[model samples]
Target: MTAPRLKIFSGNANRPLAEEICKAIGVPLGEATVTKFPDGESFVKINENIRGQDVFIMQSTCTPTNHHLMELLIMIDAARRASANRITAVIPFYGYARQDRKDQPRVPITAKLVANLIVAAGATRILTMDLHSQQIQGFFDIPVDHLFASPVFFEHVEKIGMRDKNLVVVSPDVGGMKMAAAYATLMGSALGMVWKKRTSATTVESVNVVGDVDGKDVLLVDDITETAGTLINAAKVMRAHGALSVRAAVSHALLSPIAYDRLKGGEIDELITTNTIPVDPRGLPITVLSVAGLLGEAILRIHNNESVTGLFKVKGF
Candidate 1:
């Protein structure tokens, strides 16, 4: 026998999620101690030896983003020095991915920079879900597994049952039309777009609506929603254009202060998203589905050296 190969570890960010993933994968979470010092510096120590073992570290850089990211780097570095055979960063949500490109001069390509940091920290591979940009996958020199949360989201939407074939998948802006179009094709519905102009970080103005949305149940699709400006603006336009009901499906909900403030006022009917970030479904008008099971399955297959292409399918959606 080649011997048992997988060892899963988690940093301080989302241990509850890590444990859930471990349960799905049929493995115990590797013991590790992560803490902060008085000066607010990070400290990490692997409680169990991982020599010659394939180590997967689960850490989502959400909330206290920089601190969690640093913990992941430290853990990976520790794994490398501990002689782990291969270290795969199982980042269900990659932070700093929105800065994948510089539309203007003097801005840093932060997504690529984060990739370099992972490589420098001795991570052999990366696995993440629904990045802000697909091209971010190319930023890595090491192999990357880019998974999508669509299958999980589609399952919920399919169960709740859409109203009719007249459903329209609306993209909040031109940049997200590709994802929206895919949803449209999957649902056997039409596609539409809202013309928006961003005024500032947390503010936007809706200019116009493209294509037909009259008397259709609208599904607004986007990769992330931090400030809720884009989503609120788009939903307003979609509703004004005679959309019967407007619901949104977002992959990540970084729902900042402004987002929470505005979203609580009820612009969109139901906001569906994955728990790639910290989620509290209790108070908000949003519903969070666990991607833990999906991510867990992918991690198990990766550990066994099995094909993960199967995770990327839904014949209908």
Candidate 2:
């Protein structure tokens, strides 16, 4: 099959990541103007001709989530109107994923609504990583490429020499057991879980630990963390249970001010995460790993009509 001409663009959200992806793929970043008007409206202009080209717009719906989301929609519309052959929305961090279901009364499923909006805006495909819930893929009618950050995390873990140490993978809550299990299985380590109760939106109370973590180096895995409550509280409980050290590997670290304060309490030794969204560690023991190479490779394969299943395969497993 003939590979289509590829063009990559970036919005205000995480432009550095998009540049890194272009560097990894050995392609020049596409020229585009994504700006805001004085009235707070998003304006997008595709500076280069994308006619019959395969276009990918990279944007993470992170801080100022609605604004970034609107920029992506406008970019998609611009690409479609410019006669692009295929337009893919490369969202490293998919915002609003946590609202995938209608669990409360008089509430909307915002994730589904966002999916509908993307389809309506003329996005032919979606490439995103570490969604808050797996079911969010079903919300889209178009082709959605859901990627995991396990490979990136595993590479870093290996580099940090954590593989040979007596390690235990832990989930901060029962809901994250599947992710923790995947990490434990890949690393050939023991598994543990912290049963947590949410008292409020930003507060989590870790009640107990479920498995053996005594004197073991604990690695807590979670999809995303905005408040640091779950991870910090879990680390505290694990330490109380005789854990030697506690570190967290979260896919998206959308740290707020309160999160920084909680992190300074010294419950966790290190906070490892992906650069899916822009993160400023503020001199903390936070290690931000890049997923650009993974995403760039996936983009190349997708544009060339190749399989991307190999991207999920971990080495130690």
Candidate 3:
């Protein structure tokens, strides 16, 4: 069997996560410098030889989204120029994914554009998790190892064990019901949803709940949380209608300043999230489960040309 040449690198998007993934994989993060110029242009320098090596660059296009994304693209281009055997862009929380299609007049499919940019930058593979839409995987011409945060949250929550927690998993909007139903099945709970209207780009107002959350502990699940308007509004309504407690499990906890304010103001009891997006609740009652191990294991499997399907078997075990 041929030996594996696994190397991981990171952009400024989430360096801490990259470090943890490197630790789990037991490999030094490939040496690279991702900096910006005076005009905020991205510059990447690969300081090591990755020729013939299987390379994975860990970068999440979170806040400062464009800069981080450009950094990733530049890094991939550099690796390709250096003759790396393969390059995988391991995006944790793929931004620009929400605009996967052009539904409006004279609109651009930004998600497809990002896909083109990555491929053009010479990314041979893609590994991402909890995409806004699973269909986004098909947006890539190359292979996409789409993963989930269920294992991370399930293991952590199951270990602690919820109390009297007959639950109703909640979707803050119609778009998220499928994800909410999946969580309900995994947790052996009921399913519910909040009908919401987007009042603004960062605000969503909950108008009604289609299912029962009354007197039940709620597990509101979604793929992302930006300003927390929708989440907070849902929780507020549930409480008014007799929800015992409103706990949340989001794949990406982008807990913005307003989100933290909402969570701190007694809008949510427990917030379970992954490290896909850097969100520090400043030691609040938020539980952050590291997905580094999950990503690391997947990277190993991909490098060895192994099936990554089993990663979901035991929650990335």
* Model 2 clashing residue pairs (backbone): none
Give the number of the best model, judged by TM-score: 2
Measured by TM-score, how close is model 3 to the native structure? Answer: 0.95
User: Candidate 3: deviation at residue 149, Å?
Assistant: 0.3
Instruction: Estimate the TM-score of every prediction.
Output: 0.97, 0.98, 0.95
Name model 1 segments beyond 4 Å from true.
315-317
Q: Is candidate 1 or candidate 2 better by TM-score?
A: 2
Model 1: per-residue lDDT, tens digit, 13-108?
888889989898789999988998999999999998799898999999887999999999999999999999999999988999989999899999
Residue 70 alpha-carbon offset, candidate 2, angstroms: 0.3
List, residue by residue over 1-317, the lDDT tens digit for candidate 3: 55548889899999999999988989898888889899888889999888888999999999889888899999999999999999999999999988988888999999999999999999999999999998898888999999988888788767776523577888988999998888777777778999988878888888998777777888888998888888899999889878988988999988788888878877789888998888787978888889999999999999989999987865423
Query: 228, model 3: CA deviation in Å?
Result: 0.3
The stretch of ten residues in a row with the least summed lDDT in candidate 3 is: 156-165
lDDT of 2 by residue, 112-174 (tens): 999999999999999999999999999999999999999999998899888755999999999
Backbone steric clashes in candidate 2, count: 0
Q: List per-prediction Cα lDDT, in the order shown.
A: 0.89, 0.94, 0.88
Q: How many clashes show up per model?
A: 0, 0, 0
Task: Tell me how far the alpha carbon of residue 146 in candidate 2 is from the true structure, in angstroms, after superposition.
Answer: 0.9
The better candidate by lDDT, 1 or 2, is 2
